[model samples]
Structure formats: structure tokens, C-alpha cells
Target: MQIGSIQLAPGAALAPMAGFTDAACRRMAARHGAVYTVSEMVSAKALTFGDKKSAQLIANGETLAPYGVQLFGAEPETMERAAALIGGYAFDFIDINMGCPAPKITAGGAGSRLLLEPERCGAIVAAVVKESGGRPVTVKMRTGWDAQHITAAEAAKACEAAGAAAIAVHGRTREQMYTPGTVDPAAIAAVKAAVKVPVVANGDIESAQDALDLLEATGCDGVMVGRAALGDPWLFGEIRAALAGQPLPPRPTLRQKMEALRTQIYEMCEEKGEWTAMPQARSQALYYMKGLKGAAALRRACCELQHFEDVDRLIEKVYAAGNR
Candidate 1:
């Protein structure tokens, strides 16, 4: 799938998760075969207001090419101004976030709430596209506001007509809120059928088989992995290999996984300083402990982490628990 000049071979991307898909996590996914990665969502209104934290979110710190910064807002003028402000950055494109289902985001009439008004969705897309510095403008959106609406097909068509270079459909309504087992691939398929632009399917894809299943179900040009890539960024490589009809790569050993996790955490510390990054690392560490024996105890340790030494101590406990 090619968006403008960006060639996303294998059609795999790292979805723009609010706090999780930061620069460090994005770099890890890129190294493992994610062809595209978007920065965490930034508030268009905040950027327009000169919010320092919002400015920091779109910082071009990662070395990966074809990177993008995602922005969210209800007002077309605010989104247009925000896109123009970040035009100096080295982003290949600007992605409009219309899929976030968080209460705070939806309450502001942005994110998935935009799905309720397809015309407004088109206006917002057109506004951003007009100021995108000649770069392609893309959109990430949900199936609809709720099951009763199911308006993804209509919204996607509006976005395409308004100059969205591509579209990513998360296969659930705002009401689902990432609930387990609620993904509706049929909704994603609807969006794919409605848009001429490249369409990417997202939601509930954890394994290579899940990725293949979504592709078959939606006929989407790409798959975007979110939470599953937190500790296991290598899932992208596995999906890529599966799509290429090649043997899957061997799963990393426990020690290798630990090293990978360390790389991710340490990079975060370097980028944002230990003080600010460690608190976030607590949840990130828990993602790595998923499905392991004594995970309950490991998660307890993860929650108390406060510094690099704490992470080191936790690693020792993990090794002991794994009998490695």
C-alpha cells in the first residue's frame, strides 16, 4: 500500500496509540518491519494554543522515514492551523485522529464523535489537507458512533472525497471502547469497499494469523497493530513474513525478549528522562509479562517500579520466575 510517495510494502503499520506509541515504541516496531508509524495523538486546539506538551508530542526524534503525526479536534480551523504549525517537521504525512474512543476525546466532539457527522468529518479532512504542506493527508476512524449508526462507509467516502490520501478503519463503534472480541471486520470491509484510497484495518489483531484473517475479511490494503506491539514489536515481522508466504521467524528467547524490553525502556528514559519515563514504564513492563508464569507477581513488581534500578531488580525476578 502506497500513500503518496510512501511505499508500505507488506502493508503493516504501527497504529497511533495515545501514550503507548511514542517515539521509542515506534522505533522498535519499525526495526521489526512496521513500514509506517504515527506519533501519539496531539490536540489540535492545544497546538494552536501553543501548548508546550503538545509541541513535544510531535517532535521528530525517531529516525524512521514515512513517519506521521496525528492530530485531533472538532474545529476545522483549529486543525488547519495545527497542521500548518507542524509542517516544518520531517513528517511524511499528517493523520487525523477520528477513531479515539476515550471519553475525554469524544466529549470534545473530536475522535470517534466525528463519525456521527460525515459532513463535518469531510470538512475537517479538507481543512487539514489544504494546509498539509503538499504531504498526503490521511484519517484513522472507527466504524461509527455506535452499533445503531454503522456509518463508517459513509464517513470514509466523505473523507476520501475531501482529499484523504488513505483511511484506517478500527472495526468497532465508539460504544465498544476496545472491548475484547467486539471487532466487526464487516464494518472495515464496508469502508474498504467505499473508498478508492488505500484502506487499513485495525483492532484486535494480535498474532500473524489474526492479521491474515483481518486482511481476508476486510480486503484492506494494510493492517495496523496497536496494543499487541507494546512489548512484542516483532509481531510486525511475523505478519510481514506470513504475508510473504515465508516461514515465520522463531520467537525470541526469554533473555532476548528481556533485552528487547530493556532497549525500549532505556530509550524512553533517554528521550524523556528517567523521572518522567519510569512512571509510564510501569504499565509497559506489565505488557511484557503477559502470559508468563507467575505473571500476577511480576505485574505487582511492575507497578512499583520507580527507577532504572527497580527495572533491573524486576528483570532478575522475571528470569527466576521463567527458570532461565
Candidate 2:
């Protein structure tokens, strides 16, 4: 699939997930086969104010080409200014985030709240595009504010008309907020039909078949994997194989899974010191334990991780559990 001039060979991309799709994670996804990857959302307002942390989030030294920097904010001028500032950075495109359903984001009238005003959504996209140094600008958004306000089609049209290169629709209203089993492919199909730009579908895709089914159901250009890919970067390889009519690769063995987790943790440690990365590694480690035997106990151990030696010890315990 192609977004503007950027050609993505695989039909899958990694979704921008805050606190999750940092450099280490994006690099892992790329190594596995995600055709495109986006950085965690960076606040446009914060970047304009010289927020170093938000600025740091846009760094993509570890991820491969076709990577995008995602920016979130409600103000058009601020987003425009942020785009200008980002012109010096290396990225394939600019992604505007309007799908985040977190209360802190919505409370500030950004994220999913932008869906409440279709015109404002168009304005923001246009503003960013104008200052994007000729780079394509994309938008990620939800179906709407709520079931009663299913406005994805209308909003998508407005964005496309205002120079958006592509649109990614998370198939749930803001009210749904990641609730399982609530993905509305019909809403995504409407957006695809309403716009000429490529549209990517996201939500509840946990397996390769799920990715294929969503593409068929919504007629979207591609699929974006989110939380499901947290501990399983290989999911991208599976999706790529499925997309290309190739046999799926064997699932990672328990030892292999443990090694991948450790590699990711050490990479995180390299980027942010072990002390800082270990605390965050706690949750990441738990994701790798999903579906393991004695998962509850393993998770308890994962939560206590505070140092590199602790991770090695946990790996030993996980192996002792004989999880397949």
C-alpha cells in the first residue's frame, strides 16, 4: 500500500502506542517485518514550548525507513508550528493523532475530542500539511465521539479534502475506549468509501487471520497492529506472510520469547539507563508472559523487576515453569 509517495510493501504497520512504541520497540517491529512504523504520540503544544521529553519521543534512530512522527494537539497554529520544527527531523511522513481516548488528552479538547468538530479536524490537518516541508501528512482517528455520533465518514472526507495523505481509523467511538469486541468495521468501510486516500483499519487485531479478515471486511488499504503487538513483534512477520500468501512462521519457542524480551529490555537500558528502563520494563516483561503456564505468578515476578540481574533471574524462573 502507498501513503502519498511512500510505498509500504507489507500490508501491516505498527500503531503509535504511547509508553510502548518507543525506539526499542519500533526497532523490534521493523526487524520482524512491519512495513511502516510510527513513533509514540508527541504533543504539538508541548514541542512548541521546548518540552525536551516530547521532542525526544520523535527520535527514530532505531526504526527503519517509512517511519512517521505522530503529533497530537487541538490547536491548528500550534500543530503548524510543530510541523515546521519537525522539518529538520528525519521521517517519511507526519501523523496527526485524533484517536487517543485517554481522559487527560480528551479533557484538553484534543485526541478523540477533535472528532466532535469535523471542521477543526480538517483545519488541523491542513495546518500541519502547510508546514510539513512537502512531506505527506496522515491522520489517525476514531469512528466518532460516541455511537450517537458516528461521523468517521464525514470527518475523513474533510481531512482528505484538506490535504491529508492517508487516514487510519480505529474502529470504535471515543466512548468505547479500547473495549474488546467493539470494533466497527462498517464505520471504517464508510471512511474508505468516503475518501480517495488510503485508509488503514485498527482495533482488535490479535492474529494474522484477524488482519486479513479486517482488510477484507473494511476494504481498507492496510491494517495497523496496536496493543496486540506489545510482546510479540513477530506478529508483524506473521501478518506479512499472510498478506503475501506465504506459510506462517513457527511461533516463538519459550526460550526464544524470553530472549526477545531480554534483548528489548537491554536495548531500553541502553537508551535510558537501567535504573529508569527497569521500572518500565516491568509491564513490558509481563506482556511477554501472556498465556504462559503459571502466568499469574510469573507476572508477580515481572512486577518486581528492578535491575538487569533481576531480569536474568526471572528468565530462569520462567524457564523452570516449563512453559511452551
Candidate 3:
């Protein structure tokens, strides 16, 4: 699939999930076979003001290419400045965040709130594209603000008109949040039909079959995997295999999962120091241990540890449990 001139191999993409799609996670996902991965959303206003943390979030990872950076804000000037600054960096694409439903973001007139202001959304896209200097500009958005306002089709058209290289549609309204239900495939297909650019479908794609079903239902160019990628970076490889008409590989054993977790934590420690990385690994460690027989005990033990060595030891203990 091609977003603008950027060609992405068929299969899975790592959705830009907050707190989970950091540099370490992106590198791991890429290494495990994700064709593309996006950085966590950064604040456009903060980036324009030179916020160090926001700038740091957009830093390039050595092993992760086709790096996409997502930025959020209401003001066109702020979005434009952010696009200009990021254009000078080593990013592969710039994505405007129009899908975030967080109240704080909406209260600030940003994120999914842009759905209500299509004209301003178009202007912001135009400003970012102009400042991008030919770098591909993409938009991630929701179905609408609510059931009464299904604006994704219109927003997709507006984004395409404003020069968006691609669009990712999450088939749920801001009010739906993350509820469990059937995604609106018609809404996604409508957006795909409304746009000239490639459209990527997102939402509830947790398995290889789910990916295939979404692609078929929406007639989308690609699928982005979010929560499902959480302890399972190998999901991308599985999706890739499925798309190639190959047999799916066997699921990893608990021992293998623990080993992967250990390797991930060690690599993160090497990159960010034990002090910083150990704490960051807590949630991921829980994710890795999720389905194990004694997972609750293991998660508690791992989460209580303050050092990499402790994490390694806990993983070793878990691995000793065998297939049970």
C-alpha cells in the first residue's frame, strides 16, 4: 500500500498508541515484522513552543524506518510550525491526530473535536502539508462526534482535498470510546470511497482473521493494529504470513514469551538506562504475562521490582513453570 509516495508492504501497521508506541516498542514491532509504526501523539502547540518532551517523542529510532509522527492541536499556525520542525527531522511522514477523544484535547478544540469543524480541519491539513515540503501528510480520525453526527465521509473528502496523503478511519464515534461491538464497516467503506488517497482501517482488529475481515469489509488499503499488539509484537509477522496465504505459525510458548519479555526489557535498559526503563517495562511485563497460569502472582512480583535484574529474575521464575 502506498501513502502518497511511501510504499508499505502489505500486512500489519502498529497504531500510534499513547504510552505503548514509544521508540522501544516501535523498534520491537519493526523487528518482529510490522511494515510501519507511528510515534505516540505529540502536542502541536507544545512542539511549536519547543517542549523538550514532545520533541523527544518524535526522535528517530535507528532500526525503525518509515517512521510516522502524529501531532495534535487546534491552531493551524501551531500545526504548521510542528510540521516544519518535523520536516527537518528524519521522519518518513507527518500524521495529524483528528481521532483522539480525550476530553482535555476536545476541550482545547483539538483532536476529534476537529470533526465538528471541517473547515478548520481542512485549513490545518493545508498548513501542515505546505510546511511539510512534500513529506507525506496523513490524518487519523473517528466516525464522528456521535451517532447524530456521522461526518467521517465528509472529513475524508476534505482531508483528501487538502492534500492528505492517506487517511486512517477508526469506525467509532468519540462517544463510543472503546466499547465492544461490531465496527461500522459501511462508515469505513464510505470514507474509503470518498477519498482519492489510500485509506487504512482501524478498530478491534485483534487477530489475523480480523485483519482480513476488516480489509474485505471496508475495501481499505490497509489495517492498523492497536491494543492487540500489546504483549504480542509477533502479530505483525502472523498477519504478514496470513496475507501471503501461508500457514500461521504456532503460538509462542510461555517460556518463549518470557524470554522475549526479558530481551525487550534488557534492550530498553541499554537504550534508556535501568532507572528509566525498568519502570516503563512494568505494564509491558504485565502484558507479556497475561495468559499464563500463575500470571497474577508473576505480574505482581514483576511490577514490584525496581531494577532490571529483578525483572530478569522474575521472568526466569515464570519460565521455569513449563507448559502449565
| Index of the highest-lDDT prediction | 2
Candidate 1: where is the Cα deviation over 4 Å?
A: none
For all candidates, the clash counts are: 0, 0, 0
lDDT of 1: 0.90
TM-score of 3: 0.95
TM per model? 0.97, 0.97, 0.95
Candidate 3 lDDT, 161-270, residue by residue in tens: 99999999999989888889947888899999988899999999989999999999999999999988888988888999998899998887766777778878877778
Candidate 3 residue spans exceeding 4 A from truth: 320-324
* Over 4 Å off, model 2: none
Residue 230 shift from truth in candidate 2, angstroms: 1.0
RMSD in Å for model 2: 1.1
lDDT of each: 0.90, 0.91, 0.86
Error of 1 at 220 (Å): 0.7
Candidate 2 Cα lDDT to native: 0.91
